[model samples]
Target: MKHQPHDAPPGDPDSALAGEAEGYLLARAHHDQARREAEDLCARMPWLTAAQAEDVARHYTRKRIDLTRQMLLSTVERASQLRQEYETRYAALRRDLLKLHAAGVCAALICLGGAGALASLLSR
Candidate 1:
């Protein structure tokens, strides 16, 4: 039910939360860098030279997008792994608690029985 970022790389919810992985931020930075690079190239490439500015821009943009997709996938997979681990640990703790509770109930019943028997013997 927890909401995650729609923009996050395919799998890295943890990286978005932790902000620790260089890989997770690569896509955003890459896109910015590509824009800057394309701008610089456009400024230098004279119109007289008839450079393919649009093609160059598209190529860099696509590369940045692809890298971002890769990062997203990695993040998502790690999050899923963490989720599974938590589930396993939670299940174990629940089992242990149930066992302890059962033991306590048994001990209480035994103590009550002993007390009742003692009282009956004293009455005789």
Candidate 2:
């Protein structure tokens, strides 16, 4: 599941509902994936007793879930860091662009003023 950053302001009911729904879906998907992995592991070692297999499946599932949670948290953290870095860079670029435009306007005005002064002197 792709994680999306929430855009709604705090205290918005719709955003809260959407967040809850997304959380539910993510949890369900993770559980389903862990179950499949556990089953696959059990299938590979069919000689084990039923009780032992069950125990092994439970342990494997727990570990898999924990690992997946850690990885997801790591990914989310990195995504946040990247977003901050990008936003900062974008702001700096916008500021530079504004400065360049202001400089160009000033240069154009200076050239026009110089031409006007030269024209007045020639007329005199």
TM-score winner: 2
Kindly provide the TM-score of model 2 when superposed on the true structure, using C-alpha atoms.
Answer: 0.84
lDDT of 2 by residue, 3-62 (tens): 344676777777777878899998999898898889889989989989988899999989
Cα RMSD (angstroms) for every candidate in the order listed? 8.8, 2.9
Per-prediction TM-score: 0.61, 0.84
Candidate 1 is scored at a TM of: 0.61
Model 2 clash tally, residue pairs:
0
Runs with alpha carbons beyond 4 Å of true place in candidate 2: 1-11
lDDT: worst 10-residue window of model 2: 1-10
Reference-based lDDT, residue 124, model 1: 100
